[model samples]
Target: MAKVIMVQGTMSNAGKSLIAAGLCRIFKQDGCRTAPFKSQNMALNSFITTEGLEMGRAQVMQAEAAGIAPMVCMNPILLKPTNHTGSQVIVNGEVLGNMSAREYFAYKKQLIPDIKRAFRKLEEYADIIVIEGAGSPAEINLKENDIVNMGLAEMVDAPVLLVGDIDRGGVFAQLLGTLMLLEDSERERVKGLIINKFRGDKSILDPGVKMLYEKGNVPVVGVVPYMELALEDEDSLTERFDQKEEGLIDIAVIHYPRISNFTDFNVFEQMPEVTVRYVTSISELHHPDMIFLPGSKNTMGDLKWMRQNGLEAVIKRMAEDIPVFGICGGYQMSGYEISDPYQVEEGGKIRGMELLPVVTVLQSEKKRCQTKGKIGMLKGCFHELFECEYQGYEIHMGQTSYMLNNSVQNVCENVISENGKNVYGSYVHGLFDHGNIAYRIVKILAEKKGIRIKDGVFEDYQVFKEKQYDKLADTLRRYLDMEEIYGMLREAHLE
Candidate 1:
């Protein structure tokens, strides 16, 4: 069996995911074969593995830190919210069905066998496993049926390191309150407490840290400082979306209510000359060199929302003047019409932005794959993109059919416009992952705006991310007591 250690947070965005990722990096650095596991994840942010299996992007990031390929077993169950009440339930990389809160709550306990099986599979492959829990373990109403947090800790006999965000304020309360809410058995499972996202000098927080150790009766394992990293974020709770700063080249991305895989745009932020803003409303959206419609979990509904909020009209009018691009759900929305025949989404046909000569029909089955192909002949704003070989992944439940004219050519399953205009879209995520593609896009945009881009602003995506993981590991090693963490893992395995 693999030695196990789990990181649980006092609240959502309490820095659990990043901390867990840091540990994964540490374990890998120590030459321990490590894997990250989560019994369940609830987020629209997700990734498709090379085998076409789906998993949470958080686990994918952790797997990257471990220097390993991401697998669906890392996140056995994923719930993507479609509305306030219901979500699309994905079990082991395939959709089980849509379930409401009441229905899933009653049914989740049945997934124990699945979780156990996945964990066992990980143990066979790893010397150690870094597990992450979702949200807080202190929800009394939901604790009984919990398969994450303390419940999962007990299940896998994994010791927990509870993390609280000091930057959010009330860190003391957050940690103590969570400990207070847990049952005695659950509390004993917590090996240590960590104060995450702390700013300022260590001496100023010394008294508070001492108080926390005395009151909580758990060792203060670490006080990690707030870090500004360009790594991928876990979910919509990410602060990357609210950024409104402008740069030499401004690119606006429409923020849907249930956006998924917004990491596609993260590569764009690598360049100092470019600014990418997530526009929630028309007022937040201003003139930009390019406009992007990102992937959404609820495409039809978001399109409707765009219509009611008048963003759709603005985008359509703006498409006439500037370059417009879309991905996945956004690609579906940019067509002539979208029809959900099997009610995969809210049923019925809806009018699209009419930007492309394509029509999309949502199917009951989803296609998930890592695909690569040569870029077809394109025209207009990014005609330079043509003949450039690119690689990306596809995760969508719709099939689009477009009438190809002189300009539109098949770049795998993507589309482009005629020479005189700039409207294009693709179902592939990570379209900019090819460093040169990202670099070239910036170059094209800068040229159009009559600006100069700085050199050495981009590198291979894998290289950039690996350096980030190392930076994270170095920070954790400097502040966190790795000896204590290793002891916890040892103790868990011995029993």
Candidate 2:
């Protein structure tokens, strides 16, 4: 048995995932074999493991931080939201059908064996397992069948570290209230408390931290400061909502109801001249030079939302002369129509923007493979020798066919665009991952707006991602008591 230490957040997006990842790095650096585990993760952003299993991207990031290959065993259950009320549940990387919040809670208890089975495999090589909790365990109403938080802590007999986000305010109440809410048996499992995302001086929070330790009787292990580590977020809530300013271009992305893999836009956010914003409402869709319709878990549902909110027209009007790009589901929406004969998501058929003479058919079989291809000269106003290298993975159930423009040659059907500087669509996510491709496209847009981009504004994503992991590892080493924590791991008895 591997010694486990779990990190439970006071609320969602309280930096629990980052902390868990940090600990994973710390353990790995200290010469102890480590792995990350989360019993359940509800997010649209996911990755298909090498074993052809789908799991949350957070654990995958953590596993990478630990210098381990990601597996479905890292995250046994994943929920990819289809809409507000329901999501498609994935058990051990296989879809178990769609279920609502209420239904999933009742059904999840039966999957204890699956979670254990996955963990058992990780325990084989891991000397320590860093666990992450979902949402707040303080949800008294949902704690009964809570296989994610304190319930999971109890299940594995792992010591817990409750983390609170000071940046959100009410840090004292958030931690204390959560501890008070947990049952005696559950509360006892929490060995320490952490204050995360602190912005001010450590001395300012010292009194409060001391008070919490004395009053709550929990060890004040550490106070983690707000560090802008460029890591991939689990979902849109964390990634899209960030108010960071990158470049001069004010690129707006539609925050669909079922947005997935929004991380594709993170590359743009790193540039010093770009500002990426996610807007869900039509009024918020201010006049921007470029607009991106990102990937979605449910294309039809989000398209229906686009139509309902009159965003489809906004996008069309904006694309009259301005640039518009779509990826995956958004690519399907850029076509003439979307049909599902098998009715995988909604019944029958749906319509899409007739910007490009293309159509899509939803099939039961999903396409999940990493693909590399060249951006051959696409039919657009600013077409140049775009024989650039681009690579990304696919994770969609729809098969798309394109009706190319008469003049366009040597083009794949997967990438169809209007014969102007307007509409563009591709099945590829992270199309901007290639620095040259992104720089050229942005340079074109910049020329139109009379903005000149300086040299070296583009980042090589392959290099940047590795840098991000190193930053994550180094940040953990600086903030956490890695030596003392490693002592705990060394002392832990594997029985």
Q: What does each candidate score in C-alpha RMSD?
A: 2.1, 3.1
Query: Can you write out model 1's per-residue Cα lDDT over 141-254, one digit (the tens) per residue?
Result: 999879988888888888999999999899999999999999999999998999999889999999988998899899999999999888977675899887889998999999
Cα lDDT tens digits for candidate 2, 1-495:
688888898999888898898888777877889899998998888777656578889998899888888888999998887767888989988888889978987898999888878888888878899989999999998888778887777777778888999998999999999999888888887777888888877897888988998879987787888888778765745855756343567888888888888877888776767788888888777777688888988899899999999999888888887888888889888887788888788867888987776788899887776667776667774465266778766788888876556332232644556785477888776567764777677777788889988777677866787777777778767776665555444222321
Clashing pairs in 2: 246-272, 246-274, 247-273, 247-274, 248-273, 248-274
In model 1, where do residues sit more than 4 Å from their true spots? 404-412, 491-495
The per-model lDDT (C-alpha) reads 0.88, 0.80
Q: Judging by lDDT against the true structure, name the best candidate.
A: 1
What TM-score against the true fold does each predicted structure earn? Answer: 0.97, 0.91
